[model samples]
Target: MGDASVVEKIYDLVVIGAGWYGLGSAKAYIQLHPNEKILVLEAENSCGGTWSKDRLYPGLKSNNLWGSYEFPDFPMEEKVYGVSEGQHIPAATLHRYLTDFAKNFGIFERTLFQTKVDSVEATANDEWALNVTSNTSTIQRIQTKKLIVATGLTSQPNMPSYPGEESFVPPFFHAKEFCNRADTVQTCKKATVVGAGKSAFDVAYAFATEGDAQVDLIIRPTGQGPVWICPPYVTPLKRKMEELLSTRALTFMSPCPWQGEDGFSMAHSFLHRTGVGRFIVNNFWNQISSEVVETHGYNDDPEVFKLKPWNSAMWTGSGVGIHNYQTNFFDLVKEGKIRVHLADIVKLDQNTIHLNNGEAFETEVLICATGWKKTSEGLKFKNFSSGLSYTTSDIKRLSKEADKKVHEMFPILKDQPVLRGPVKAEEPLRNYRFIVPSGAVFKRNIAYAGMVSTVCTSIFSTVQGLWISAFLDGKLQRAPKTEDEVTKEIMLHTQFEKWRYPCGYGASLPDFAFDSIPYVDLLVNDLGLKNHRKSSPILELLEAYKPKDYLGLGEEWVEAYGNQ
Candidate 1:
């Protein structure tokens, strides 16, 4: 606002996106460092990243419980499923909550709203050069000592291709556009939704409830892992049953679950997903029964999944899992409120959508909820985020593996050359917590400012865990405790697999995932009630975790020296 032509002062740290993760880093940083030069750049005038955006149809809400989505902090320590009868926070409400988080913490003061980061470049020095445009404003460059790429995956919708729909032109847009209400083209008598993912369901449900129109839903064979709106209370009980059934099934070599003859064990699933596979048992039950879309996968898998495009995993199997229809989404399809078309498109025309079976359906208005494609159309600006040039080799080096597809990983500088006078040796050890390589150590530097150089960042751990690690190094005192350093130490530990970050495999189940309990004997740990939380509800009968005492819930470092 001052001196339009003047370049803003360089910041100690430059944070992109003001969403949940973004706010986590900023607020945590401020907790320990009061006067750091930090600047938050948001494309929209507001702070909620995904929640603040995406209107799709109305009566919109989240499937995740309100308690599950609460920020990890004091004050709002109490949680509930306020809307979904004690289930999840709605999309609109989430947006407002995040907005409130920023206002209360005064984070907006550090923000340059209506600004979009178009590109970034690595300066001759290690600092980052960002080219950002404020709403309707000229492009401006801001230099900062550090850059936080907190823009989440949802920021980009994975749109798929459809036929002859481009010319329809009534009012076609992504789910993001529908959130605003005005984005609807013609809510014509027959509205056809092209995808069956969660967004597609939301789109279909919205049109039916808000537009009062019968909706036709088109689902790709693999896109249907539909979990419906079950009472959240039942989740725990149902989960236990499945686990016991899976354990017994796997032990006695009983028939595989999910009706698979492939004998696809959960072990194999974990192997493919970096040992961090989603709960397949849950996946089957949820998708076949639930309506929320869990994964927004690209048709081009290995290409998008691998770090170097070469380190891809094999596909197991996928198809529609909509067998439970007494009252499932398919029931809506059966009731004619929502029509179902099972054929894949063989052709596309201005007025007709042809499926592979050569069947053509004429429609009044088409809601190409056909989904968005993953393209480099407008988001190529990430190429400009730093000074050093990025290559496949660069990504591999940073990933500490042949692959560079980091989902829940914190980006860091791994395998960078360590000089030893004239000759460079494989970095002997990672020096600091933020700087640790997988299962290794190195020259230590706590000033997180220059310390985002770990081999692999944990993307799956508590978001607070990732947030605090980087925040401490970047803005806070830049100090790590013994345990913090040790755990991060193991991450950088030189022992290959031991040095590697934990994969999202079979471990996320109740017991395995929550194994690292923090002293709360009877408390809920993100996953809710501990013991029964492990296996499944069927196996565990009725249950409760009313922990009389919380154990190991607080680490020595986290309790005594965290973002207090």
Candidate 2:
């Protein structure tokens, strides 16, 4: 709303969404291509993306440690987050960190706050035309050579409609909206939460433990796979185990390794395609899950509730990384303050929620902890000739087709145990190496940030931003040149996905929820940066990498590989 005057402006890069991903993307591009003009369009009034206004709910704390979750270039101010600074910070603290990061890195000045992009499509000249609407109701057209969708994963909230939900008298909304109005729940007598993710548990836990409201956590039988409950931080023993089975060592064991040859490689495809490799990775995670369950006294029974393979899919790791501070979650259930109902709601009346188990519950508030829509759907693009919307479904279909070609080429994988499951290609905005969609014919200039799910959200986003920038700057290589090659690569990744998270289909997107170290190494190595690991080889091979250990690595990489 700063200026109603609409003018056409051309930028070298137009980044949508001013959240963490957007900020990182803009920062990376500007740092590398200092002369290039980059504009970040955020719909919100302030920075921080999800960590900003959308997140200020009670009991909402980070799952990952702040030490690893912070921006590499800018360290978070000490004594601001967690008990001793650098632990699991609260949502408000994270919001501050993001805004602070933008200010420190000069990302705030180039960002267009309160600006929303309505649509982006490829023009005749291969450039992108973005129809933007500002908070002032003013419209503007932006033309850019490259468009980076940095909205991250949680852009659109998925609000599933129930039969009588529209007529419900009490407060009813998605978890995102509920967070926006969490204060109202303090007065409510009972709160009913639907879904089985971190949001669901957090909302239910907050209402039950903190407020006067009794909470009913309704987990649908047909919902996404079982949640693997675990503490947010990895213990000393777990960290040691991660080092022994590090990607560096695993890559050496692989017969087909990712060479420093191209923009992308099928090295991971080869590693995970084999049964032995799959067994080792899966077994390692199983051990971790067992340890977490034993340590926390969490339940994960194979006969009653099969734990989703942690190493299988992205974002499927220890389901909700709740902080250790919320230790009374299960205790609340035991004390009858929080009720865990493992059944779906059959119907909802004006004052009652009828479950599939024929049990009727009365609640004053109903919160849908249901997950968001596929992040790919947030990327609204159109096929230049067909005028059809480029959707997440299309991405899934393309990957499926790619997988088909791969199975045909590698018949041995056709009968592979990992390949036996139904292809879970439902989520959208599928990209090559979790960035740009290689299957799309037009607008190849667009790259997606934050599509992949990892334990360390900020670190993953930062690396993605740098990778996108390097790809745009023509410093790194791209995915395969041919469709067949891309298909083969995606097929192996899909198989890898299956082996890692067997129940990833329940996820909103195909989360690349793997260890952060190797993924970052892949990005940095592909970007042609020098080995950024500062630790000793023995330590690197023995311990899991954290953000604190790699502080300023991104800056170092930019200085070494930028505009190469």
Candidate 3:
């Protein structure tokens, strides 16, 4: 809402995307640099990236529980939000909380809604120039000394096309549009959902129970099969799944490169290095997988059995989901209300879809639950001097070397899973510690947040926010001094992710679940702060890490390194 003359004024910092990570970064920066002029640019009219108001549909809930999803500094109180412990937070509740967060932290006034950053380039004066467009078709240029991108990975929907689809049109759209097209579920007598991810399950359930319409779920034979859906409270102990996963002891079972940083070096070596320890670790994962299958009763019915996960749980990253519905979702399939098909759509005709398995289905509605694009395409980044993209040909050469080294260290990942199709090899994202680009670390003028996909997003975002503020303010004590060291560290970390989470999106992003705590520890140590938040070593090993555990981490960083 400002005039063209406003572009001449340079800002100290500019942040893109007003979602969870974006708001967190802005709040952290403002807390550290109180008087700096910082602005936040958001394309949506509102905040809450994935949980924005326009995106909320009926019966939608987060995979994470209430206690594990809030920021470290702000707790989602029961009296304020009406969400209690152990219950999955509704999409609306999360949106409200984020709206309140922005206002409380003074970020709402700094954010520019409906403004999209088209591209960004480095300037000769070691600053960033951004080309932005508003919803009213107003184009403008803005400059800032530092920039933080938090658009995340789910900004763009990945919709696939089938042959002859133009002829048959009965409300065909992606699942992300379900909120706007809610009438399709109420009016259609029958509907078909494509893909087998968490979104697919949610759509099928809504169609079957909410609308009482027959639903067909199609999972392509060539792609990864259904994901592992665990009950809210799993195992014989009946401990909350999110809490169990947050414990440091549970992460030791998973092979992670940085778990040893938590003062468990001996345990890490035994589990990943010794053959006997390997046997024990494998059995632990097998038992967990078996428990999920039995808990869901997948083997009782043939149609329900089709929902079993195709890969081992050890190889899974974010592919694992939580079953937070009020009723048993499998019961609907067992009753023959929601059908499951393991086939690919060959073509689409008028009110009909042909499958590669010599089958055809006629439906009045089609909803695609396919995943999102791997990276954000809205912003284009370029080098100031070279005028080239951040990604270069050297990535391929360095990645190959990193792969060999990772295989040597973790031999368990040597045997890779085989997908059916000719999968396109994507170049791994080259960012040191999954934040700054390796080539631009010395500049310290640009950073990324929420780029990695993890179940513990709140914890990761808060720690990352503090870390970014420290690095940009020249308060970090253990940062790499040379570009060569930064590049080497980035390549090795990316390669480890490739092997650690083979079935998920690890090839292009840092995707993890239980290992998030260790990842945060790495960042905390770099800021010259204590990684352990608990009072005793025993408690640190057994207790679950939550948002409250990290309360005052920003102040902790300030106490240790603020003066520098």
Candidate 4:
């Protein structure tokens, strides 16, 4: 049954990737335009996207609190360790929440499971044509007036190529493959994890505590030396703030100028642009962080504390959030349950891995907690295994051809910088709001979701979906209007990312680098929602911001805007 048959269909809009972003995007768009023909194609068998079953590893927990991880409208009711009171929830709980969100919003019916998009190209009518293959190897051609790429980041594994590691006898794999391979992990006597990000730490902890394997955490030296590690910030005042803000609709509104778009409230523009607000906030952050660090024994070792890349305030602002360890990780290191090694792997022997610092360790399995490769590699389509003729489509090649045609059609957009080929992992994506091409191509047929990294995944994805939908519906008022403006904004934002975060993950894209809440407010305001503050100007200036209720914000907009 190798391409024995082909099916063709046309849709008003087609969304790729059935994860949280895709589902949320589809729901938001469809809610506004109920009559539109929509289709959602997912490579996996179910919804949840990144939170799907395959990515759920043992003892995996969110970096942020569950309250922030949940959608504004659909809150988690479970009393799990990390769910109810500003704690980290298990990966499984988050998956269940995502599944429920899709069902609650009626996004399941519009979705097609186990279908992979092979290619998407612009048609002559300014529409898009997609070549997709199903899990069963059935091929189809789909034409849609609009396309939404919701695959976001984390779709591909960013595997590191180590020298001489190919000769190792034990199994070596990325963290993404470790979920169902627990048995394999248990059999290993010694395991080594590369990198020091959240996933790297998670794998190391599991191997040491669960599998009882002697685990070595390999960390590379950055500008600040060792990576920063700290406990979650769940002070009573902060928890009270979250609770208070969550029920108020105004907290979701951003008063600041968003990505240089116009129409920002004068007060907000002054505070955010003049550096006055940040200075005040910074002082407050330092005080709270010092108190927390002292109270929790976090500063018992002055040398280790000084080596942190960021202070607690800066770390939270950098989107690093806080790591919620069930037990004190440092104590484990002290107990010798987990060993920390600071060196790069130079080479590997049959039974040992040699470090550049001249230390060598016998490794049975090497676990790479390294993040995924760039979005381009993950989004790049492959031909079906069945070797069907029409099933083959190259997304990058098609995008270039479409870009040329589109530019020829709109000559003014021709001068705009077009990403002619695959984007390298090291470079930041040139997307406005991290969801649409910031160039002057004037193309609304394609949009992106979930490309941004923020402290609040659920709320961020929700606002992104709403903003993208509003953009496609022409409800936005201050989008960058010229080629030069787009280019200027992109360069400025890129530099800001580097200046703010300086290195590792945060250095690439500063979507929500320091203040994710403010970023959300900006997106919300751009969606025609009024960013309201307290009646008293003094209170507005002094209030500490937190994630708040956005459910009413959208509803109020629907009532006021009438869905156009």
- Summarize candidate 1's per-residue lDDT along 1-564 as a digit string, tens digits: 211334356877777777666776676556545677877777766777656654424655654433334454422233422343244455666777777777776676677677788776656555678877776446487887766655543455555556665665444555666656433433565566776445666667666655667776765543322322222332433442112222322221211111122233454335324323334433443342332222222223332121011101111111111121112443354457776665466655776667775667766555555433222134344323211123656534643541232222212212222221232122222322222322211111112111221101111122333333444354223334454444333323222221121111111111121111211211122212232223564432223221111222223234544545
Each model's number of backbone clashes? 95, 11, 0, 4
RMSD of each: 12.7, 5.1, 2.2, 8.8
Each candidate's TM vs. the true structure? 0.58, 0.82, 0.96, 0.79
Q: Rate the local accuracy (lDDT) of all candidates.
A: 0.42, 0.63, 0.85, 0.62
TM-score of 4: 0.79
218 Cα displacement, candidate 3 (Å): 0.8
Q: Which 10-residue window in model 4 sums to the lowest lDDT?
A: 383-392
Model 4 clash tally, residue pairs: 4
Top-TM-score candidate index: 3
Candidate 4 lDDT tens digits, 1-564: 112233337888888987778877887887777888887888877778778878788888777665566776776776533357666778888788777777777677767777878777666677877887786445577888887888867778888787887787777888888886777567886889887666777888788877888888887653223444545644555433232223222222222124223233454344443457545545655665565566445467543343244434333333343557777666666667677776778888898988888999898888887777646453543221111112124423433444444333223222222222233345456566667765313667678888766556667777788778778767775576776565554544443443334333444555453345556656876766765434555544345333355665557668877546
Q: What local lDDT score does residue 93 receive in model 2, on the 0 to 100 scale?
A: 82
- Candidate ranking under TM-score, highest first, comes to 3, 2, 4, 1
- Winning model by lDDT: 3
In model 1, where is the ten-residue run with the lowest total lDDT?
A: 307-316
State the local distance difference test value for candidate 2.
0.63
Better of 3 and 4 by TM-score: 3
Candidate 3 has which clashing residue pairs, if any? Answer: none
Model 3 vs truth, CA RMSD: 2.2
